[model samples]
Each structure stands twice: as C-alpha cells, then as structure tokens.
Target: MDSEDLAESVLIHLDVETLIPGTLKHEKCEISTTRKCYSYIKKRTFATFVASKRVSSSPTDTSPVWQCCDETFSDPSSVHKHVSNLHAEEIEQLTTAALDQMLSQSEEAFQKQEDPNESQSDDPASWIPSTSHLSEEELSKGPGEVLLYYSYCQIRDPKLICSWQSELCSRLHLTGKVRVATEGINGTVGGTKTATKLYIKAMLSHPIFKIMQVEDFKTSEGGAECFSELKVGVYKEIVPMGVDPDTISYRLAGTHLEPEQFHKEVQSLLEDASSKNDTILLDCRNFYESKIGQFKNCLAPDIRKFSYFPDYVEKNLDLFRDKKVLMYCTGGIRCERGSAYLRSKNVCKEVYQLKGGIHKYLEQFPEGFYRGKLFVFDDRYAISFNKDIISDCSYCGAPWDQYQLCSTDFCCQLVLSCSSCRQKGLTACCPVCQAKEQRSSSSPSPGRPHREECECTDSRPRIPNDTL
Candidate 1:
C-alpha cells in the first residue's frame, strides 16, 4: 500500500496494551501470510512519513501526505492489495522500522517531561531517558571499563528489571546494550571505572541478580563513548538462538573450562598433531566475528547469525560424531546455549566451553593462542591486544582486520578495507554492493537490495582451513 495507508494499517494493529514506549513490540501480525509482520512500522517509506508529519492528537489527519507517489485509498482492502502487489519483499523490515520510529518519538517526548528527582513510574508503557546526567568531573577522572556478562535464571518480572536497568545504567553514565527477559539478563555496558565499579556493587546487591559474582564480569578498556548510545529493553531471548529456551536450556550446557585449563588443552592440541583428528575447537560466534580473531586451528562456522547455529549443527552432525569438542564465543553466553545444543545431539565424546569466552582468556593471556582482534558489538567495532593481523582487506587482499560499514546507504554489510583501499573508496562488502553504491550516487532514492541477495546473509559452509 501507499506510505500513508501502510502507516494507518500498522497503527490499527499496534495492540497498544503490549506496545511499550521504549521497547519495540515483536508479536506477529495477521495482515500477511507470506511474511512475519510486527504491530509497528519503521522501514524506509514509513520512517519518512513519521519524520515529516506529526501525528495529530485529535481525530486524525485523514488525508495526510505520503513520500511515495501520490495515491489515495478508499478502503483497507485496497491498501492491503496495494501493499501486497508492491512492497511484498520488505513487509517484515517495514513493520520493524515502523516500531523503532514510534518508540523513538515516544522516548523523546518522555525525556522532555521527565524530572530528575521524581520517582519512576511503574507503568509498563512508560519510557525512560537513556542519556545520563552525570557531571563531566565524574566521567573524566579515570580509565573506563567495558563489562560483558550474562546470567541465566528465572526472572519473575522482566519488565520491572528492564526499567531498573535503564535507570541504573543512565545514572552511572553508561552506554551499550542491555537485554532482559523471563530467562535472565545479558548486557555489555561501558563507562568510567568508578561508575562501573558502583554498577557491579549495585547489581550484586539486587535481590534478583545476587547470584552473579565479580568473577562473572569480563572487563576491558573502553568508555561509554565506545558505544553510540544506551539501549535497555526486554526481549524474547537473551542470546537469540532462534529456539525455545525450554527445549535447549543452559542447565544442559557442557563443562565450563577456566582460562588456565583451557590454555593447557589448547597447548596440548597445538603440540600433538594426531590429537587434531579426535579433538575439535569450535568457534560458536558468527562468521564475521570469528574472521577477525580466534584460537589457532579453531573450527569457525560460516553462519551469519546465532539463530542459524542449531541448523548448522544438525546439518554437520557427522563432523562432531565421537569427537571431543570445545566451543567459545565473544562472551560465554552463546556457548552456554550452543554447547547445550551440541550436547543434545549426543554426537560428541565430550563437550567443553571456555568459561568466560575470549574476553577472560585475553585478560589472563593477552599474547596467547588466540590471534588478531576481538569483535565487539559497539561503535568501536573491535578491541585488540596484540599486533597480529589475521584477517585481510576485502578489496586488496592486504593484511587488515578493522571493519567499516559498507558505504552503500541501504546496506548493512561490514567490509574489511585497508586504509589505502578505503582512501581509494573501496568500502563495499562485495562487487554487487560496490556497483549499488555507484548507482546510489546518481539517484536521490535508492531501493534496498533483497536480503537473499546480500552477501551478509549468505549461509554457505565456508572452508575453515583457509581462515587459519
């Protein structure tokens, strides 16, 4: 349908009881059968509508203008028909983008009305400002710390926990992503050292999070500025393995190996060539993450997202049959569930996961078996410890590991381009994306490529031997 009609159709299905001000509601919509639709809209055309036109508080702007070509619809059926006939491919993304813009506008309005000393509202739909009001002196005193940690336990009130986390992080002047769910909490927040210390103290004191210990936190040198902004919300899954948590729970996870123990195991595997045939070092993270850095001779999967891990394992069952396996990720959360899935298959002789993932391992052994940089989910892109460069530039084949978003406006692919190639404007992930960038320069509005055609979405099994 046209942009205006699409927005109208979306608002009608928003299910206001479930749509909160700060969180994007992710329930499926019944509007379409072919695609999974959300109750909100935030995609390209709808986002433009939200930005240019303000929603009236009264009856409504019945004939609001839309960015797409001039069009008028008399009924909902006509709008449905128009949308199905034209924008079928992007229905899911469109709904997701719509929810984001709506939530953003609500957050902005909340900030304007918020009082620093006022008590927080218990309302589920209430939004809190993510930006902190800490003074410059508090934030400028010392080194910063980025904490990575996750806990899996029953949370009776995730919405309440989500609300408290937003306030806590904002008060400490922290930035990064925090996700809370019925299962537990997973977060990576960065801020001043003092603030981070206070945060850990507060978390340990909390009745629900008391199960966490200081050792659970994995810290690195970074500040709130390492991330673009603060984001705290509740979600379906803490790690998003795309499976029911009840079916594959962390309680069924494999043995947790401390840094020293894991080090000895890796050393033995590296020294004994014959052991390689019976032992497997598997990287549970996605292809992009493992590409920059991993333990020497590890088996890194070629999947793009964690949700695909179960499928990858099911298809490659024979690879792990009767073999002793060791798994790891950026932090340890993925392995908690990943190893559980692997063990559920009952194909391995024994399964083990690095207790704190690569973060803790790097702290104990900065120049150890793992090489290159650690890929992070923030504006900093990655954090490095050693001088080794394992991955190469996507364009010129020069040794490099730094990642930059593709220059193509509509593309989300991350490309590894050396400074020389970047200076020459070689930033696209592949030849297909580079051509799209050239075309976008001449057109005012460029259409986004289908996800199936994007290089970032490719799921083919990549040859692991070459990555090492």
Candidate 2:
C-alpha cells in the first residue's frame, strides 16, 4: 500500500480500552502513530525538499554522537582532541554566540551618546519604566528560592503578551523559551520567584490555565529551582504532538501516590519486591531522562522523543500487559496521560506512578531507589535525585547520560553514559538509537574513526540504528 493507505491500516486493529469501570484513553495511539509515520516520511523528504530549493548545500553529514560505558579508550588523547575540536566546535560556537549577545547587550545605557531619543525607540525592548513596586524590606523579607516548572499557553494579546514576559523576566530574571501563536502557547519556563511572578500573574488569570486541575495547571510539588530558566512565548499547542482526528482520553486512572508516599513505596518495592518479576517497571520518561535513573525492574523504552512514547508503549503493551505494570515519568505528567491510555487498552494488570515524579521523590529520599542524575530538557543538564549510582553506558559501558539517544540524526538518539564516555566520544543511547550525523546543524567530523561500529544494545527493547 501507499504511505497514506499504510497509515490508515496501521491505525486500525488497535483497541484502546480503559480498565477502569468505564473510560477511554484518548485514541492518542492513533494520533501519535500517524505523527510518527509522517515524521518518518518527513525526514525522508525534508532533505529533498530543501535540496530542491537550494543548490549550495551538500548531502548533510554530522560528527558521530557517541555514548561511552565501561569503554576505556586506548587513544584518550586522540579522542579528547577529536571531541574538543570536532564535536565540541559547534557547542562552543553556540555558547560563544550566546555570550557575545549577552556581552553586547550589556553595553547599554549610553551617556550623551548619538541621539537622546534613540534611547527611547531604538532600544524600546531595553526601556524600563521605573516604578516603586515594592520595598527592600518586603523583597528581602524572606530568603530567595528556586522554582522549576512546565508552563504553556496560547498568546491572545501580544501588546499585553510580549511585555508581560519582558516585564516579569526583567524583574525576576528566569530563563526559558516560549512561543506565541493564534492557536495557543506552550513552553516550559523556569526561574526565580520575583521573575516567575511576572508571568504567573497573567497565567493565573487565563482561562486555559483554569481548565487544568490543581495538579496539572499548578504542579508546585518539587522544591524550588528544579528548573533554571523561564521563557514565555506563543505556540499552537504547549506540547508539539500533532493533531489527528483520533478520539483520545485524559482522566485519572492510576494508583496515584503522593511524592513522599511514592518515594516510600518505590523503596519498599525495591527492597521487598522481586527485581526479577512477572510485573514490569516501565519508565515513561524519554530515553535521555531514563539514562540517569529508573526502577530496578522497569522497562526503559528506546525512545528519545516524548511524542513517540504512546506508540512505543502500544507496540510493547503485549510484553507488559497481564503483568503488574508500573509506569512513571518526570513530573507524573506522562503517567497522568500514559496510564489512562494504557488502561484504556487493557495493556497492564496494575498501573501506578509517582505523584510528582523523581523531582518529588528526591525531596523525600534525599537519596533514592534509583541512581545518578536525572536529565532534563532544561539547562540544568540534570537534577541529581538519587545519591546511588546504578547505571552505566551501553557503548563501552562506563557511565550513562542519565540521558541517552538513538543513532539517527533525525533521531539523534538520546541515551545514558558515564562522564568519561560522555567526554571521550559522541554516540546516541543504544545501538538501536539513530545516529544524528547527516541531518544535524553540525556534521559528523572525521577527527576520529570508530574502533568498530557500536555493537551495544540498550537494555530497552529496540535495536539502535547501526550507521554511526
């Protein structure tokens, strides 16, 4: 069948049933499957589409993204130079650019410079109308704290919107990315309170924010500063999962454990429960997030993207269903939707997840049932929730990313590895993971050759693309 016909056939034969008395997990499976197919096709055609329009570009290539494990390089120096010169070049470029922009922007407040009014309009973005907002005593009434969170919404009015972000950001100084769209806004912005308060006010008053329950709309469980930046903008939807006409479901359908309680329960399971079990522990986190830590017997799906998760779970439901299935994600966000979806399909016998995710678990355990750092999409690299170091890399097997990847550039596999491996080379999480060389802004540099094509397998189900 043609791609379109295949897509339809794929969507059929998928039965989504909520195990609860009566409920339906939004046929998110169909929506996600369709998107995955389109993405596959898009990646195949995007280059052609671009090449058709431009003659100056070459077939894209990239530096091999590597994941190191027990791997100790005989050529450490060579690998270091290769990493520093080859893979790290563009990372340096972006950092340098960001630094330059910050530096140049800091050279403001000219005295008797060119034109006086130039200050007014030329730097409208810089202008701040001063006002006596709060007293030093009140602002200093309490010690400052950190706030990490995911916040998204659509932009209704920019005159009110852009300034809203700028004003609060200027005052509180949180850093993140945001998008504005007619459809709606979606982004995870994080920062300090003084700054968060700026955007918080607008959201607190919006209708969309109101629609979500106290848990989702206002998930303030993890202690301050789990997130480092706060950015606000407009986007079509907060999360970029594509839209399809699949009837999807989103409702409570799990043994939701509070953060502290979940922490205790996870520990209890690890100590008392069998690591070798008929039940399956499923980490609903993206590949990168799982690289850091997961339950003892959990099933880590080799997926880098969150949008692809439902599809992965659908494909693997057979392996886990009939068994006691415990699933979880960072902030319980995915489980909130994922568990409900799974039950809709009768995929697992028992479904449960931590209430606030590892973020909350960390607060209670101080150390945790899992180990290592938790990779976040934000700039903090990862938050170290567990004191124990339980994971290592899949490649040479030294350490894991606490974040992992696949081999395809389009699938620039996110995976886990140790610090030494992360320093030595570039590779995605599993061998099944895609190598990202060809399509990334950075091409695979030939500074170093592979000892052999990576033969590692992620503990997860899929095999990584082997072309890196």
Candidate 3:
C-alpha cells in the first residue's frame, strides 16, 4: 500500500488520546470511537512518529554524502500529515529514536521517585545502593537530625491535616509531635536524615504547603532518640496563645527580619541613645523559656504559660506605647499571633519579629548575643546556643541551666538545681515545698496512704547521679 493509505489505516484504528504525549487518558478522542483494530506497537516504537529527528549515515556524521530526514511535528494533526507523506523505508529509524526518548523519560521518572541521599549517582543506569547492607557500626555512627517547621496559614479541616500528617510520619519512621489546628500546623520531629528529608517532601507535597520551600524549615541535629514517638492531633490553636483567632491574623503580624538583619537592628537600637529608651526587645515565649536563655537586654514577660501573655500585655501596655517593639518566640509561631495582638492595640510605634525565632538565629550564629541554653519542649529540655550560664540553681543558688522537675512527689513545677544540690535531695521547687515534704515523710500514716490522694506527691522525681 502507498504511505498515505498506510498512515490513514493506522490513524483510523488507534486511540488518538493515547497516541498524543501529555494528553490525559480519559480525554475524549476527536476521531471516531468505533474503530480500534490497529496492530499495536510498543510505546517506544510509536514515539518516533510523534517527533522529528535527523539521521546520519555515519555515527560521527563526518561524511558529506549522508541524507537527513526531519519528521518532527508538535501537533497530532501535523504528525499525521508528515507520516502520511513519508516512505516506509524511514519507519525503522523513527522507531529507534522514539524508543530512546521513551526510555529516557522512564528513567527520569524512576530517578525522581528515589530518595535524595549523598551517595546517589547522577547516572540513570547506575544501580541505587541499598542502606540495608550497611554495617550496624556505620548506621550508628552519625548524630541523628531533627527538622522543626511550622506554617501559619489557615486550615479548613485540622482533623484531616492531622490524620494525613500522622500517617506520613509513621510511614517515614519519624518520631515527633505535630499539632494541627484552624490556625495552622506546628511540628518538631526527629529521625534519620533520609526519613526527615522524605517527611519534608511529603509535607510540601500537600496542596496547602505548595508555596513553602524546603529552606523555610528549621533543622537541628540531636541523638537518635530525640523524640520518643510520633504524635499528631488536632488542637484549638497551634501554640495555645489563648487569644481568639478572629482577633488576630498572622498576615498582619510584625515585620519579619532574618537572623543577620535582626542582629544588626538589635545592635543599632541598643547603641542609639534616643531609640534605646523608645525601643523594647520583647520575648514572646514563657518565663521558663527565657529563664534558661534570652537575648541581651530583652524584656521577657514573667508569665508561666503563653495563655497569660494577654494579661501580661494588658498590665504592661504603658511600657509598649510609643515604643518600637521587637518580639520573638521559640519557633516564631507564638510571635505570629503575639505581634499581631500588639499591632491591633495600636500601642507600639512599630513591631518587628525574628523571622524564624531563636531556632533559626542559633543555626546562623551559634555564638551570638543570645546567652545560655534554649529551653525546648522535648525531653532534651534545653539546647545550648553558647556556654554562658544565665540561670542559677533554685535551692543552692549555684550557676545552673538544666531544668528538673520539683523533687516533691506531688508537684510538677520545674526548677533549676545544681548537680550537687540535686544529689543532696534538694528536689523541691522551693524551700517551702522541701520543708513540707520533710514533715510529711516524717509523720506516721494514720491508715493506708493513697499515692494519688497524698498531698506530698512529687510528679517528677530526680534520680540520684542522673539528670532527669
């Protein structure tokens, strides 16, 4: 048959949608639906007719006597027209080029599916080495890593987000706590580098996080068991600031400054004689967080929990008025609402916040002006940014930064106690609690004592010779 007749016969029998590149499988074909009897060719062989390529008689194309055939066309109609006019002798070469392109695409897709590891090679044909064969010594050598990230965008269904996050973390073998709420998502997780990278990729894969980049994540290195297990749940608020979401919006929060810029601005404000009195560096975190470490000369509120921040702000409104307020929190989530609240009141001349909070700052400047350890919510309790000891033992008044729960069996309050004092049985949060505990232990029980009902129960007890 002539090429034109052969092309027509082929086109009449094939599914047009499947023949076209980048077309959806369910897309309706413009051709008649009744015809479907073409002799099926491999996808690689069919790819040749879809695109044009020049063929040389020699591998190097050094000879001048070679003929070049260009059959490439973009639209399906144009490709059909080119195929119809082409001779059957050219079919073999076209099929070969199309198969090469198909193989390239398949390999590209497979490479994209593989995990990103330093040991991975750029050659698509190279086999991916499995970590399964690595020795236990090699696996246990590196320090574990953790990636802490948060988003302040509105979440329509927090429960759904929580469920997806839980499954994703579990599948990746990650251990951390993630809280999803109407306000947004807050998470602090730790795992092997591969698992953390996969977790980040999975998180950004969600439609809600498409705008966020991987650099937006804050990462820290820790031991393998930094977190005990994965816990994902829906909550009223991501940070529990206690303010109504309607009253504040993160979009209206204070100016966000990067670590270097924040440090410069802070130094400049401190040096300016006039602005020094008019500017206030505010710590938006709880008193316990600031007690372990804080920015130099910052006005950290003396509140136990973030919920009491509103009351603290209301009482100290006079200090904020006509001042340029610089605020920050651990991971910047608290500052998102805290700065917005300050702006809503119209009390400060200007409000600026640390972009990623202390965590980001420490990553950039490990020995910056911030002194002592940064209190964290995990079992690590705190991580040191610098060697500066800014806190003292509550019992003995010696320099100490580690936080330990009160030695009293019933109280859960955390207190700083030097190793010597903790070893000496000074575990109570205060002297009053210590004296009360002694009296209770000395007194004889009238009847069987209920551990839960006992007034002198210590929720956290310090084990001797070990840090709690």
Candidate 4:
C-alpha cells in the first residue's frame, strides 16, 4: 500500500474508539488533523482550546489542499483568536484576498467531481458539502422536533456547556451543535419550528427547564427554511468562559428587572439622553448568532462564546455606562444574568437591559423593535425581523438567511453563503473535512479533524445513538 493509504488505515484502526465518550477521553474531543504541524492554545483549565491549522502549500500551482478560508495564520497559535472569536468575516476577507493573488490555478474544488460539458483542465468541479439536501426519511424522522436543555448553574460547573454535550437532545434531521450540563444547556440547533417546539416543551417540563422560560420557536412568513439537521448534546456548563474561576459568575431572572420594566426603562433612557452623549446599544450574542441580526444601533460583539460577553462589555464599559446602556441577547436569561454580573462588579453605572430580552420585545414590536436578524438557538437557525437581513453571505457576500453554512472545515460553524456560492461547492467545512478524511495517516497529521474547538458528540449519556 502507498504511504498515504497506510496512514488512513492506521487512523481508522488506531483506536478512534479512544476518542469516544467514556471509552478513553471522558469528553468526545475526537481529533483528526488534516495536515501536519497542528498547534493549539488552550485555557489552563481546558475550558477552551484555541487552535490554528497550517496547510502545506508550495510555490507550485498544483496542490490538492483546497485552501478554503485558510491563510495568514502561519500556524494554529496565530489562528487562535480567529476560531475562538468566530471571525468569519476576517477569515473570509483574508482568504479571499490571498486566493485572488494566486490565480495561476484555482484550488481543487474536490478531487472526484467531474463536469460533463467542460474540459477537465479548464474548470474546477465544486460541491456544496452541507446537508442542505435532507433526505425524506431523515426529515420525517423528526424534522421539527425540539431538543430541551437546562442547567443548575454554579462556579464549580462553570464550564458545563462544552462538557455536557451529553444531553440527550433529539438528533432528528438537524445538524447544529447542542450542550447541556449542571450549569445549564446551550447550543445552536437547526431544523423546523415544530421539532424545536417539541424540544422546548420537553425542557419547560424538565425539572430544571421549569425554572427557565424558553420561547417556542416560530417560523418566518417569508424567510428561508430552518435547519437541515437536528443535532443535540450536553456539555459541562451552559457556557464555557475559559477564564479563571474568580472571574466567572452567573445570575438569572428574579435578580434583575423584569422584561417589561427593563424595556420601558430603556425607551425612557434613550429619550432623556443627550443626542451626543453616546447611547450604546450592545448585542451580547455569539459572533455567528450576531452575524444574522442585531439592534440597528447596538455594538455587535459578535462573539462566538457567551462567557466572553462580559469581557466585551467591560472593554466598552466606558463608551456606554456613562450614558444609556441598552443590552440584549437571544432570551431575557442572558441579559438578566449579564446585567447582574456587570452591576455586581460595578462595571457600568447607568445600565438598562431589554425586558424579556429580544424575544419578548419582538412579540409586540416585531417590525419596529429595531433592525436586522434575530439569532435563535433552535432549528430555525435565526429569524429576520422588520424586513432586515443584515448577515452577509460567507461565499457570495449577499444577504443570506440563517440556514446556510460552508460544508468545509470546521465550517460547521453557522455562516451565510448565497445559493450560487453554495452551488459552486465553496463550502469551507466539507471540503476541508473531506480532505482531512482523505489524508493519509502516515503524515503524522493531527490525529483527528479540526476538533480542537469542538468535540463532535456522537451520542449522549441520557440517550444512546443505538436506541435511536
């Protein structure tokens, strides 16, 4: 067998089972690097593992490595902030710019695709590797089924979300990430609203979900379809901050102003503020989530992880606290706790948070609450409110709905890619993932796919895949 073939065989046989949950690694962080010189920057406590990938490129125009959003970062270390921050725009910009300069030959779209009318040496064949083409059987299985999540939050369980990918959220046909643990449940599930409703129902009835009021997901009248897969899992904490224990804290509903009161206060605060005093509208959702939508005037932190919200807020504390501080998130839960946490530390002096968070406000002012899309945590991916679709297409730069993402690399992270771009097989997740899959094991490549940032949970402690 060739050297590369030998590696593939070794990888499949080299105890991939070792990466499975409860088998060797308690958490399913299975890794399979597509290339060599894999490096990562992880938090001391393992709360986060920021990694960068280095592709073996040469002066030759001939390389199998389809350099999809892979550039600038000489190694994984420099790419640390890129992944942790979900800097899709920055990555896209840099990669596109670099690819433009090297037009001597386009990257191989995929090795196997063939065009009937075009010459093999002239045009590259491409495939949108995402599961957008859901099979009828898979859709019927649980197209719109909801997967519930909850958390018994505390410092000890501060890192619950990543560790708890053990929650038995319904897999169905959805393909987004989910996590639940002692601290709470958090994730991005995509599918039909009905499937989401079932999941929400289960959570509302769950012992802990009973304490939290998760909104039942709704379908858009004239928007893109929902998630293509129903992925669900559990983690250690609802949100992993990757910070020293001393900096972590969480507070919920009862401790803060009610949704209505908070909303009224914000409206009044805005009216009373001096026009030039600098009223700051802050969006506290993850980067992927925020890319879809935000209040017209809010500072979009566009963070990838929730725990980093505080840090973003602290950085901008001086810019807003002195004036009017209007904060919000997917639901009121985050704002309630986020505002409380900031107030506890005296981070902001004049603060007003969205009552009931954005969800509640959308109930009455769906068309007028602000502008742009609203990030959601269920199968709906996200909803475009008030005729606003601000998120950019990752590939074509068009305004895209929430359901699309590159099927390339860990491009598993949600992103906007136009239909044309997707059809061009430009997904970043799938091509890279497939390349990683085809890579020969002998290269001493990272032992797994780009999983340093995520451990794809194959099954959950409460619900076994075999049972499904």
lDDT of each: 0.74, 0.47, 0.66, 0.45
Model 4: lDDT of residue 456: 30
Candidate 4 lDDT (Cα, 0 to 1) = 0.45
Determine which window of 10 residues in candidate 3 has minimal summed lDDT: 31-40
Give RMSD (Å) of candidate 4 vs. truth: 26.5
Quote each prediction's TM-score.
0.68, 0.50, 0.64, 0.48
- lDDT of residue 194 for candidate 4: 43
lDDT winner: 1
Q: Which stretches of candidate 4 lie over 4 Å from their true place?
A: 1-178, 184-236, 243-247, 252-278, 320-323, 377-380, 392-398, 401-403, 407-415, 420-448, 451-468
The order by descending lDDT is 1, 3, 2, 4
Q: Candidate 3 clashing pairs?
A: 52-72, 407-427, 408-458, 409-457, 409-458, 409-459, 410-457, 410-458
Give the 10-residue window scoring lowest on summed lDDT in candidate 1.
30-39
Candidate 1 achieves a global lDDT of: 0.74
The residue-by-residue lDDT of candidate 3 on 163-245, one tens digit each, is 67776665556788999888778899887776676567766665566546787788876734877777889987787878777
